[model samples]
Target: MNAPAGISTLDRVKIFSEITIKTFDILVIGGGIMGAGIALDAASRGLRVLLVEKQDFAAGTSSRSTKLIHGGLRYLKNFELGLVRTVARERKVLNRNAPHLVMPEPMLIPILKNASYGYWATKAGLTLYDLLGNVETPERHRMLDKTQTLAQEPLLNPEKLQGAGCFVEYRTDDGRLTMEVLKTAHTFGATCLNYCELRHFTYNEEKRITGAALQDKLTGKNYQIKATCVINATGPWSAKIMQQDQPEKLPELVHTKGVHLVVPFEKFPLKQAVYFDIPGGRMLFAIPRQGVTYFGTTDTPFTGNLEKPRVEKEDVAYLLAEVNKMFTGLDLKPGDVISSWAGVRVLLYEAGKKPSEISRKDEIFISASGLITVAGGKLTGYRKLAEQVVNKALEKYFPENRQPSGTAKIKLSGGDFENAAAVKGFLKSCQEIGQLHKYPSESLAYLVRNYGTNTKAVLKEACRLKAENLDPETRLLQAEICYTIQNEGVTSLSDFLIRRTGKLYFERGQIIAILPAVKAAFQKILTLGNGILANQESEFMEQFEAAVAFKNESKNAMVSA
Candidate 1:
């Protein structure tokens, strides 16, 4: 089957008309995975859904994750039974539904002597994790002896080897999967627009929310998007929206930052994904991703501003230090990192308690003003949380006849697919035909991971501007970058180079050096309103530079901050 094409400008105009001209049934604030999940769930249920984001889709924590779709084997120690079951079920759903994006991953937990969780404890956790999703998920966890463990992962630090345990989970491209949800929502006739900020709310005499007034962060245009119900699925920003609706009862969010670093895959030891202990027992991932070894994610409580959280210089050092401890010595350094990022997880805040100790459970607050605020949950359990939030909202509207959300059975974009190898062959054939002038073989593999079946569309976009016009390093023909601006809704170069193409995480310097080329592409593809190029380019470059530097910051600052 052929892949999908980009949204047409006429279609964009229609979406604009619906969002700005017509009042929607439900307005979802946030276009990350959870918000996109909510939009897909609600739209499938026959609701007129409108999803809005302050930044590009998956621009926040959703895109900047360890990119694992698992049953939360780590949470098994915390004894979060419900979360485990829900996430396990959701993981199964993701694997079954979005097969194109979510692929099975083998995780080797290298059990060391006298570790935080020993061999038996790790085995028990894996058993529970597998049981949560039932037999259909994957093979049950198995124990490996010292010699066998070394055989499975010769790269593992063997001095203190007490054997290793293997379990089944999943790996995915988080940003693309989130965008697939957005595309799925759009396919079901939902309205989604990025750079649309929720400035404030509208209230009736009874103080029930009528909707919200949004400002397009790009055009500085104001819009009053009226809706019967408004949902705050903004993850960490959920508390802020809740406060806006009920200013007196200020609720708190247990926001904790998680950071990940990118390095060449050869630097990280082991084959399958390795889930091991970190300093402070806070947890971190050193997963192989996108042909690069990306290690991450220390969970520490934060009390800083909710905007862009920087990955500190020390946090990077700390992550390198921890991996160094486990692997003995990979000789990784700050310079080895191509990119890093910090995202505030929306954990449930309990007064006088640390964020790490706080519950991973989600919360849904139905305000007296009819605003539905959802916050604090792991990504794996987003669909279940959405059902809970949507059900609460539906109760007010339909009362006794309210049915729960049935997104569990629904498929997202390119869901239930099995043609990755065939698609790769197709792409290879196209390149052989001189269809692509700029894309390199090395980068094409990564692009396949990022673009999925829609890769043809991107290639077609490049081909549209004459195949002979590309420079070395593929500088991605001028047409391809423009497709991102017009079709993928990239509001800035950072959104394009960082999340859209996803090069920033692996090769930002090479990408940035060709900014003038990208700018030229922007000029060619984006037929914007008059005189916005200079202003837009300056703004985009500023965002692009900041995004680049933000990743260069250390992991300890990311964790400690």
Candidate 2:
């Protein structure tokens, strides 16, 4: 889709110019889901907002989540009814507003004879879960007998199985969701610049924050952005940014690491999503998306570098062991892992509690310098968190100009369809367009689902590339690349593969197969010199090799053991 007028384009020079000249009403530091949601919320309420990210949007913990817009069912086990209700309600709102990105997914929690929670207890929990979330009757929780549970997912282990609790959750494309929110905010006149780092804050006589000094990572150029209120929504890095204001205060964040492993569908073949408790009393999810099944998330306290969190050998081993035990006659080895990702969850520090015991609730802190900092929130609760943060900033800075948030009702970019039926109609229309372009039906459906109303724009770009003498598949990928670069502010090949398309997790082999064609298209469209292209290629290769090596090393270690 063509960028709305006055919205900054992907060009760094133009964005820098706008940031230098304009004094925004709200400056958001960080472009993850929190910052993106805050920008959208504030901008939709008529605030002149500017969002700056040190890296690509969702390049951090936002993209590394379990990819579920789920109510915290496990939190119920902790007696945190309030968190569950809030997340469940927010999940409904997200599914309603961004149907294209968040889709209903049925999940099964298998009950075993030796399970921590007995059958009746499990049923009661799910019943309360459904009621609290106001789940529709058709999608409400149901108790399935052992035979029925196995039928729903035949691969599940039958040994010592009692039954299963089935309920509906929503799955999402985390990175795409963040981008769409920012895009919608842009449509409402929010200026967002990725690859821009907030170096320092500008202060007034009374030490009130007036603006920020930013440095563009790509161009190495500095720019100043003045705003009436500056918000620090930097997720795991929130403490570091807060320290810039007051070095004497102790850090309030305790970061925990979560890791996920992806395996091909043919290898795992999970028919439905499964939430199972392991021997350690921690829960894990095995969810199917596209042609692969991904299971995650080992939560352990982490003190390592946050930016480059890799799946450690122990993390992969624990997941593989649990998955193998949960499945029937299937012994999953380390080699089964195609790709892995690790992310840090910035949680509020609670003394005398384990990492998993720390609350996921967000906290807002205001420094004496008038810098508003928000930290430690879940992805599902991002919109509500943003609303609260924006409201606080407005109340503190613009008390006379406070506006009610309209973000809960406003559709995200590419999410303007009237309903799910409308989305289906859009997909059907795209299939018809695909017929005219000789595009595959399945590929066209993928595009429509991923791009929503913007499928037409992507198809237009594909049609324009038909004369390039590329293969059908390459043409489709080239079209997406072009659309991403032109529209999504994708500056690097990694951003396109990892975040924009999710090929890194779901289609790792396909990415390797199409790398050459993708690189060629990138060079042609970006007009990058060979030196710059080489550097980008080197970086991509390093990441690709690291992922491959992680898997290979695990397999080798297992074999040696």
Top TM-score prediction, candidate number: 2
lDDT tens readout by residue for model 2, 440-524: 9989878866777877777878888889887777888898888888778887888888888888877888876888888897888
Candidate 2: worst-modelled 10 consecutive residues by lDDT? 1-10
**TM-score to true structure, per model:** 0.89, 0.97
Per-candidate total of colliding backbone pairs: 11, 0
Whose lDDT is greatest here?
2
- Local accuracy by lDDT, each model: 0.73, 0.86
By how many angstroms RMSD does model 2 differ from the true structure?
A: 1.8
Per-residue alpha-carbon lDDT of model 1 for 177-274, expressed as tens digits? 88777877777778888878999999888878898898878658787878998998888888787888887875666778887888777666456677
| Stretches of model 1 off by over 4 angstroms after superposition | 1-14, 135-138, 399-406, 416-444, 471-479, 528-561
